[model samples]
Target: MAPPLDPEVLRAALVTRGSGWTEVEHHDSIGSTNARATRLGRPWVVVVADHQSAGRGRLARRWDAPPGRSVAVSATVPVPASGAGWLPLLTGLAVTEAVEATTSLAAVLKWPNDVLLPSDDDRKVSGILCEVVTARAGPLVVIGAGINVSQSRAQLPVETATSLLLAGARVTESTGTDLVVAYLQRLADRYAALVEAPVTGGALAGPTGLSGLAAEYRTRCSTLGRRVRMTRAETNGAIDVVGVAVDIDAEGRLVIDGPGGPTAWAAGDVVHVRLDG
Candidate 1:
């Protein structure tokens, strides 16, 4: 088991000069960081909880971690509704970057919201969820991230999930705090650039627009250049689209080349297909 978060240390580091943070709150136990962050209803407010009694993941799936076994944090920030689709992708990229920089783990993104460790057979180390909330000021995006920190193999909720300790990354209390600080800093920098990117003629621009970010996401994404299955819900029911993930479009949709040609999906569950013969 890793040491519990040092709340005082975290506050001191994050509330420093020009950290781009308005408020930072750390909880020893909470229902959900995302829920609390949304209620906070302010931009640049970060809420972190060591234990979530009612944590949830994509598609409202329950995500539970024992006390101090994971890093659960949520941050609210203002973002354009037009570019809202990019929040999850941006958060995933930021998490992987932070984990890799703070520890000895090589992390990669699995489309929309998962951070995976290839060394561990693509097991997930972190999951991200973004929610757009309307406040008196404007629209704010609450980005929540759950990172497995010190769970043993037996303690993992699923066989596909692994923690920093399980993946051979040392997890001291300071290191854990460092990871959170790093992710917040990176997310703030990228979000600032993304918000300033202009929207003209209803199309995002290239390079100067989200193209640079799109390109970066593609490079870090392990879903590209692989056969995959995408489950999407339609008017009728949920349908599975099997295809090769070709690219991430300018608007942050996944472009899949399948039997019916190419289709772009804004939201769906993506699973990489592995063929063993």
Candidate 2:
């Protein structure tokens, strides 16, 4: 079982790791940790909030929840590798591994960037949000992560959401901080490696030149092989796209074979479903 979280203990662990973090601000409540990190203008920094007044997810959806039971953290990294667009995918993998290290449940990745738990419940326990900021120096990537640590079903806003505790995780208050920090370290290590040797071309060619990450993403993604509804930016708007998720292209785009033929989805909202349903 994991111990409870203590802010002071977390601070000491970070210091001992020699992370060279420019800042580590603990907030009672914040609109968004990613937004806060972006506005801070520093690389290798972490922002954590006990409560989020207005946490956000992809497509600007609300991600707020009660404080102290979840881990909401954001970190900023300077100009990544030449072909580092796959940072989001890599981050997802790192998060999955980190969660598994601390708990017994098997975690899976959804297309793009969501961590899902196995079982008919199909609830989302964690999510990653990536935002890019361009500067004269280069691009600054802000990666935000949220994990449901201790909330119960009654405390959840919707049935579709879940927490580690509700899922039979053994996490004490003292262990939460260590678990969060461990995950962050894993992310940092992966991010550093990506910056060093980004997947550039050849066999692993992606739309954004991060095909290796895309391939790994496919292995753990549950979105493939399911009927899906996609809302594209095109005039047609929402369309039915049902097919086995064939693969993700080098540019990190989703490739699906449907009645209309093989299509590469660049951007849109995808909801997976059972064909019979």
Candidate 3:
């Protein structure tokens, strides 16, 4: 097993002049960082684990990484109910940017929350999850993220996943600590920018808010402009649609121009398909 996270080292790495982050709890292993983070009432606090017994991804999918080869983290941030919807998208962007900047890889997002290598040779490298919690102080959003780092080919959990080591991430010299620090730093700046925008006037798409964010998301997304098989869940049941993905609207929904017509979806499993299909 890898050495557990040292709080003093993390404190030195995480300290920012004006950032409000106060506490950090590290574990060699845990059930889930997200589950633990939601139980904490304080904002700007973070939880991290080297291994997870029951880590989960979107749609309650099982997710975990090999110990010492992944970074699993969860952070709590105070946010309004209106802004809560944007956290998932924002978290996705944060992770993508952080990975690209840190690893020097052509990383991109695969809509909603998966981060991939590139469009032509795409493979999942990271996943993000955002959940809401209520406490005595108010409401908070717990953002959880996991990244495959130094794992070798034989160690990968799935055939469709890649790692920083495989991607030739030259800058990943130190360890996972650098990655956690980088991701949290970027997330902090992104969250601060979101807080500066107007929360009441739908300014999430406006200048001060997530304005150009959607466009960045679009550019880095391998889903748009490709044929996709989408499976979306509903209260009644589930439906599958095969279509050409056109755009991601300001609300972060996937716009699909399909055989029947055009539809936008908020949640779906997107499988990129060939034109022959």
Q: Over the stretch 198-250, how does candidate 2's per-residue lDDT look in tens digits?
A: 34343334443344555666777888777676676563565757666777766
Q: What is the alpha-carbon lDDT of model 1 when measured against the actual structure?
A: 0.85
Per-residue alpha-carbon lDDT of candidate 1 for residues 190-241, written as tens digits (9 for 90 to 100): 7866776677778655576677777788889999988988886452335568
**How many residue pairs clash in all the candidates, one count each?**
0, 14, 0
> Tens-digit lDDT track for model 3 on 56-108?
88877788777777778999999854445556777888888878766678887
Q: Show where candidate 1 strays beyond 4 Å.
A: 206-208, 233-238
Clashing pairs in 1: none
Give the best candidate by TM-score: 1
Candidate 3, residue 10: CA error in Å? 2.3
Q: Who wins the lDDT comparison?
A: 1
The better candidate by TM-score, 1 or 2, is 1
TM-scores for all predictions: 0.94, 0.85, 0.89
Looking at candidate 2, what is the lDDT of residue 53? 72
Order of models, best lDDT first: 1, 3, 2
Query: What is each predicted model's overall lDDT from 0 to 1?
Result: 0.85, 0.72, 0.77
Better of 2 and 3 by lDDT: 3
